[model samples]
Target: MARYELVKRSVALITLTNPPVNALSSAVRHAIAKSMEHALNDPKVSAVVICGENGRFCGGADIREFAGPLRGPPLVPLLDAIEAGEKPVVAAIEGVALGGGFELALVCHYRIAHFKARLGLPEVTLGILPAAGGTQRLPRLIGIPAALELITTGRHISAQEALKLGIVDQVTEQNACEVAVEFALRAVAKPLSSRRVSMLTTPCPPDLDALLEAVTMQVKKKARGVMAPLACIQAVRAAATMPYSKGIKRESELMATLFNSGQARALQYCFFAQRTAGKWTLPSGAQWNNSKPREIRSAAIIGLGTMGRGIVVSLARVGISVIAVESEKKLLETGKQMVIGMLERDAKRRGVSASLNLLKFTLSLQDLKDVDLVIEAVFEDMALKKRVFQELSKVCRPATLLCTNTSGLDVDALAGVTDRPHLVVGMHFFSPAHVMKLLEVVCGPRSSSETIATAMSLGKRMGKVSVAVGNCPGFVGNRMLKPYLDQATFLLEEGATPEQIDKALEDFGFAMGVFRMSDLAGLDVGWRVRKESGLTGPDVDPKNPPRRRQGRRYCPIPDMVCEQGRFGQKTGRGWYMYDKPGGTNAKPDPLIQNLLEMYRSRYGIQPRNISDQEIIERCLFALANEGFRILEDGIAARPEDIDVIYLFGYGFPRHGGGPMFYSSMVGLERVLERLEHYHQAHPDVPHLEPSPLLKKLVACGSPPVQKWREHIKTMHSHL
Candidate 1:
């Protein structure tokens, strides 16, 4: 609803009253339409000022309403009436003016924005273009190029930037409504013809066709499988090429195409999935809403390798004083140099001074004794981590929270080493932690609800999308990765080349294929893990069998590659060959192809040409099947958490909605059939076998992804 009052007796002030964000709900839209009519018809009212209750103007058209049929007054007509009204209308924008909210502002005769206000047309992010005259009117107001950028990327801009872009009439430090009301009073006498945005001509560039083509190519490369950005470009083109009426019609047509798309549904699900991932729950009933997190002002990081240096920078940049430790003076100096350089470069990008004063590098573990928390980022070896934890127990205060930055290690095993097991959790950060958005807060069996909350809160403070996963080997994200990688290597053994497999994955919307990503991450890391696990190397039972490890099928190809000093990009050759050490451009090596041929010949196995469909089905379905196993085992509470992990950490395409959601979209029955088919073909590969949960769900009519937790909750929870 909307509250109407006569400010200064002559100017009618209409304030939207939907709480929190004052989103344009059906009632609010109807109220605005009624208020506008009253203000326009009344002889006493000379002008109108539109604003929202509280600080926020509007978030957008009620996204909740998007799920159902179009109801209430349509936005396009409501907005058109406001723009065509005889009386002068001013928009007072604060907090956020996004999607339909920004579109509403464009129709007003004048816009006054608070200095802290953010504005943008962000419909494309939800996989729909702004269809309520936004595409047509914005280009007419600020020209085509700027409008295209704003609509396509959904990037919010500061009030100062909006002013520079000519999106707002004035920027103010005072209450936006007061400024807009006063400005509206003076605008009543001005010529309304010049202020009407729809009447204005769009500023078309000379190389408009070429400029559009360039953006199209960039969109295809950067966001390969997404459709909204492409539709947005078409809408903008219509605005530049046609009249306002025709452009608005074209914009609606484009929105219709994108609105009902599966991509839109996936994107919208992702928008909420991110919010849901943060709401961590435990079997003991301790959860996000009830658990209070401790305030962390200072922290420490042990070791100064790539992960450690990044962790140090992440803590220090967030105003948390960081104490970085190294085993030796020489190692400490090297880490210090790298940390300082990364911080400076990051600061320059964000236009802030590097927080050098918050950082302290030392060669002693004793320096970390007084810190509130300590994160161990040393080697991934259990013995080494246990020793480090035991030392920290002896040195640090009893109340200190201890964390380890391990991707796939046992948090419980690490917890057993610490005196305060309840406070020992895992804060797994992706490489270059200062940059990656994901932080999997691994909740151990003994980790207190308060401890988990603190880790999750701290990660959020450092600009990370943290998800609390159960303490298990590899946790949620990496735990599911094992089976997926196995299927990929199996394909290589069955005649598909690395490039062909990688192409299938890349075409499916993954930013990097498995082999290429392994090369970038260094092949030796997994090689060491495999060696430690007795899967390969000197510790393995070489006399037993060549391709069988314990009871399951094993691939020794990665181990062989590492044995030859081919440690990926760092060593110049892996699955693909680089130009030199540290080079990035990967070229398929004939040596790898020849090696594969010889290995197949030695095994006396006949190879067949594999179809792209098989590559995608095996790689992706196997990935989802493991996700089901993880859920059944309670390592991941819900499919959303698993999806969020992939989206932020492993470069899983957002349009696919992670593997679990993708499986649901593919139909649980179809996935079950595919897994059965593959497993029947390769009985040696246990990963290809369908998870019992997948079969159970298929038999039970395959409830949607959101409903999967009901079945998973009945099983024992690892959290």
Candidate 2:
């Protein structure tokens, strides 16, 4: 709810009283419109001032509304009312003023923003355009080019940047509400007609045709497979051609079209999925709401390899003081240089200053004595990690937090070597940590809530989306990834070639297919892990199947490749041929094709041409099946959590709404039927076995892709 008070100073204050982002729902919108009407009629109220009760102006339209029937007053009419007001209105923007919130500001005659304010018409990012006359009025106010950039990209602008772009009239340090009120009172005498943006024509570039073509090309390049960007372009085009009312009509039509798109649902799923990931819980009953993160004014990192260097950069970029530990003096110097070089490159790329408040490098453990937290990224061997943690527990303060950078090791064992077991946790950063946005935070059994909170906070500070997970071998992301990788390898062992499988997944919307991603990451990484686990090489059991290692499904194709010294791009050969060792350029390899044929013949397997559809269904459905199992076991708290992990960590196509969501879209019955078909075709492949939860849902007549979880909830109650 919102209200308007007519102060004696000739300023009417319109306050959005709703808490938690004041997401302009129907009631809020109605209140705002009524307040504007009241302000317009009062003769004494010469001007109006608008601000939110809480720090945020608004997040956007209530996403919750998208789930239900839409029955609300259109926001355009309110904008029209605001624009046609007898006196000037000043918007006092603080926190985030987004979507219709920002559109409301555009309707105002003047805007004043606090320094911390972030404003944007971010509807395009949510797979919708600003239907509240934003596309129409923004172009009229800022010209076509600027308006197109703002609406098309939906990028948030700071108060300083907003002023520079002429999006805001002024930025102030004083109370934004009070300042806006003063400005509103001062602007009463100014001509309101000239200040109204809707009255002005959108100024198009002289080369209008060329501009249109450029925008089309840019949208095609950047927003492939998305509907919102294209719709936004069409709306902007209407702005240039039609009158204001007609242009608004076109915008509304475009909004309706995008609102029904699967892409819109997927994009919104991504938004809420990210928020859901923050609401993590552990088996011990600790949750995000109850945890308190300890402040880390200073931090330290052990070792200075590529992973270590990136860790240093991540910490330093977030303005944390880091003491980098390296036993080798020469290597330590090299690590220091790499850290600085990376930071410099990052600063130059972002077009920002390179001066981090407290980014430091050191070669001594004594330097970690006073630091609040330490992340050990030494070689992944258990012996070395244990020794480091043991020495760290002794040298560092007892209260200091300790983290391990192991991707697949036992976090519990790592913490066992430390005196302060409660302070130990796993912070697994993907390679090139400074750039990659996903951080899998693993909580050891004994890890305190504070440790979990601190690690999650650190991930946030380093610009990573952290997913708190219980400590399993590979945690959530990598553990689930195993089944998908196994399926790809099994496909190779069967009649399919690497190129065929890769092509199938690529067509399905992964940026790269499984084989291509493996090659780029260096196939040796997985090979080394497998070898260490005794799944291949001298440790293999004599009675094991040639292609299959255990009674369960297994593929030795990757192990076979490793045996040939084909370590992917590093060796110029893997699933595909490369130009040279460590080269990026990969092409279809006739050698790999012949090798696959030979293996198939040797194994008495017929090499029938596999269709792309088979490849797509097998890989995706296998991953999706595992997702259902995860949900049943509560390994993932919700279906949305799985989506967040896949979107951020595994590059699952966002438009498809991650694997679990896509599965839901495909319908549980369909997924179950497909699994049955595959299982019958290959009875020996036990991993093809569908989760019982999936079967129960299908049996209950609940579609797999939709409303599967509702069935599970009802069944769980009986259990």
Candidate 3:
């Protein structure tokens, strides 16, 4: 509801009352309409000042209302009445003015924002456009070029930037409401024609077509197949070519098309999935709120390699004093220097001094005695990690939490070796940890909820989207990646080329395809893991079939590539060729093609024609198949947990949601049928077989992704 009263006996100050973000829900809209009517009718109220309770202007049209029928006052006409009022009106912006919130401010005669306020028309991110005259008015206020960028990107800008772009009239240090009230009083007698944004002419560029063409190409390249950004470009084009009234109609028409799209439903589901992902639960009655995380002021890191250095930078930047430990003096110095450089560069980009003083480097385990927590980011070897944990148990304080930065090693095994197993957990930070947003908190059975909570809270402090997952061979992300990666290699053995497989996946909206990603991540990593597992090398039984491992089909192409010392970008060749060692450019190597041909011939396998659709189906279905298995095993709390991991840790397209969500969007019944068909065709490829949970869900009429957990909740939870 809107609270309206006269201020200074002349100015009528109407405050929008909504907690958190003042979203323009139906009731709030009705109240705002009534307040505006009362203010316009009162002869004593000379000017109007509109603001939001709790220091927020508005958060745009309540998106929750989007799924329902139109009710109460519509936003466009309500805003039009606010603008067409006889008395001057000022918008007092504070906290955030986003989506419909920002649109409300645009309709005001003047906008006065708090110095730290953030404002943006972020409807594009939600798969919609600014339908309430935002498309028409923003271009007129800030010219087409600037408005186009903001509306298309859906990025929030600071109050200073808003003032610079002429989106807000003033940035004030004083209370925005008071400032806006005074400004409204002064503008009461001025001609309202100039203040009306709808009547203003948009400043058109001479090369309007060229600008639109360039932005169109850029958005297509960046967004790949998303629809909202493309519609934003068209709406801005309408503002430039047509009048405000017609432009608004075009904007509404575009919004209608987007609102009905499946992409809109997927994006909105992701928004809520992210929120729910943070609220983790356990079968043992431990939950997010019940478990308390200890505040970490000082921490220690063992191993100063790439992962360790990134972790150090992540910790020190957040004002946590970090002691980075290495076993050798030379390696410690090298890691220290690299860490310092990364921190300096990061601070320079953020316009702040590097927190190098908070860092401590040492070559002894004794140095971590007093630290609150110790994260061992050593190599991904179980015995080596156990040794580190054993040492940490003896060296660190009993109250300290021990964390392992292993990608897929057994967290429970490491926990078993320590005296404080209940206090140990996995903080699987991705490579280049400071840049990536995902962190998988691996919770072993022995791991206490407080330990898991602490690890999660610390990851969040480092600006990561942390998901608490059950301990397994590869946790959630890496475990599912095996089948996906295997499918790509198997496709190659059949007939698919590296480029063909990559292009299909790229067109499907991955940042990079499987082989390209492997090349970038270095092929040697997986090769080492496979060799250690006795899938290849001298440890394999001589009687074992060359194409089979543990009674399942195995592809020896990757091992053969590794034998040639083609360890990806580091060695200049793996799945693709680079210009030099460590170079990023990936060119298809004819040598790899020859290698595939000879291997297929030696195995007496006939080459088959592989379609792009088959490549997509084999790779993605296998990937989602593992996700189903993970759900069955209770490794992930829900399908959204897996989706969140892909959305952040992996480059899963936002419009498709994550693989689990994508599978649901594609229809679970269809996924189960395809898996059954593919598994029947390739009997040895067990990963292609659908999990029982998938079949069970399909049997139950294939419920939506959100409801899958309820059915699965009847089964035992792993985490």
Candidate 4:
């Protein structure tokens, strides 16, 4: 509904009403146009001021509407109505005014924004251009160069920056509506002829052609396979050449093309799925809505290794004061330097500095005295971690929340050592915590609702998508990864070369192939862990069959590579040959080929040709099967949560909509059949057993992933 109120001195205030993110739907668009009509008809209304119901003006067009059929009023008509409004109009911008929302403000005669307001035409990020006159009108108001840059990149600028760029007319400290009303009143008697933006011509510079050519080249380079960037360029060119109405028509045509593209659907799904991922539910019946978070004013980090250093940077980035602890003086000094260097780089990037140090490095657990949260990020030894948590429990405040930064450990057992068992949880951060946007928040058996809520809240504050999962061996991400990684190893045993597997998955849109990624991450990392676990070491029986473990399949290829000192890029060789240690150039090596042939002969294994399609199906379906199991157990609340974790945590392509969404698109029945076929071929593999939930769903004419849980609920009722 449109919220309309009259301020003092005959000023009409029209605010856009929406919750969460103010996504402008067709209904809201119609209301805005109707409000303008009412104001135009009423002589009592001297001037009009437009704002939003919430702090945010809008996040653009209803992204939800972009997925399915178009069912709402076009925002363009409403924008045109505002431009043609008879009464003087001013736009009151607060929070974010983006995409069509910013285009609405562009139609107003004057714009007044709060200092904290952010404004942009950010449709480009979602693989679309601003269709509601943003490309055309912006160029007419600002110059072509500035408008092109803003429209193409879709980066939001601050109110202060927008004012300087002449995108907004004024920046104010008072309420945006009050300033807008004052501006409207002041502009009432002024000539409306020059204020008509549509009637104006875009200022063309002498270097316009060169600028356009450069922008086109850059967009083509960056976008690669996307269609929207090129279309955006064409719309901007139309704005430069055609009349306002014709340019708008060109914009609409391009928008229609993007609206119908599969990329658009995928991108929009990516947006909503990301928001949904943060709302977690557990098997224990504790949900995101039911949880309450305690505020953490200060925090502590134990260990200053690579992971710990990144964690320190992440905490400081979110304005949390951190007391980083290390056991030794030398390691503490090294960590302090690394943390300071990273923070300095961050400050340089953001163009901001702090007089107060947000991070402190010390060698004692005594430094964690006043902190509310303490993160243990030492070596992955259970005894050491238990000891650290026990000591921290005694030293830190009783209310302090203890977190273990373990990739794959028992959070419940770790909590057992702590005095405050309810306050301990797992904050499994992805590699390079400051950079990656996914945090797998693992809840222990005794972890309280407040602990889970606080960790989720902290993840959001650090710009991470937090997914809550039960305490399994590897929780969600890595647990599902086990099968996928196993498939890659199986491919090697089945005669598929490392390059062939990597290239196939890379073609499927992964940024890097499996072997290439392993090489980059250092093969020795996994080798040492496997050796420590007795998966491959001196403790193994000599009678154990080669390339097999526990009567199931296993691959010791990584172990072999480590044994030979070919420990990935650091050694200039692993799966592929590099130019030198730490060099970027990678090429096939005859030495590795010789090693493969020798190993195959020693094991009496035969090499056979494997197709790329076969490789992709096996690995991806294996992971998807595990995802179904995760869903059945209620470890993940929704299919989109699985997709979100993969997209943000792993580099699962956004356009593919994660592993589960991709499997759904491929048809569940088909995926189940593939899994069954693979299971028959390898009867010893227990994880390959088809999940009962998946079989039932397929038997029942497998519905969309969103409705699977409802079916599960109904089945349980029958039981």
lDDT of 3 by residue, 314-337 (tens): 999999999999989899989999
Supply the TM-score for candidate 4: 0.92
How much lDDT does candidate 2 score? 0.83
Question: How large is the C-alpha RMSD of every model relative to the true structure?
Answer: 1.3, 2.9, 1.4, 3.1
lDDT of 1 at 544: 57
Q: Candidate 2 or 4, higher TM-score?
A: 2
TM-score on alpha carbons, each prediction: 0.98, 0.93, 0.98, 0.92
**lDDT values, one for every candidate:** 0.91, 0.83, 0.91, 0.83
Query: On residues 236-284, what C-alpha lDDT tens digit does candidate 4 reach at each position?
Result: 8888889998999999999989986666666667777888878876555
Note the residue pairs that clash in candidate 1: none
Candidate 3: RMSD over Cα atoms?
A: 1.4
Tens digits of per-residue lDDT, candidate 2, 101-126, equal 99888888999999999998888878
Residue 425 displacement (Å), model 4: 0.3
lDDT at position 447, candidate 3: 90
lDDT, residue 96, candidate 4: 89
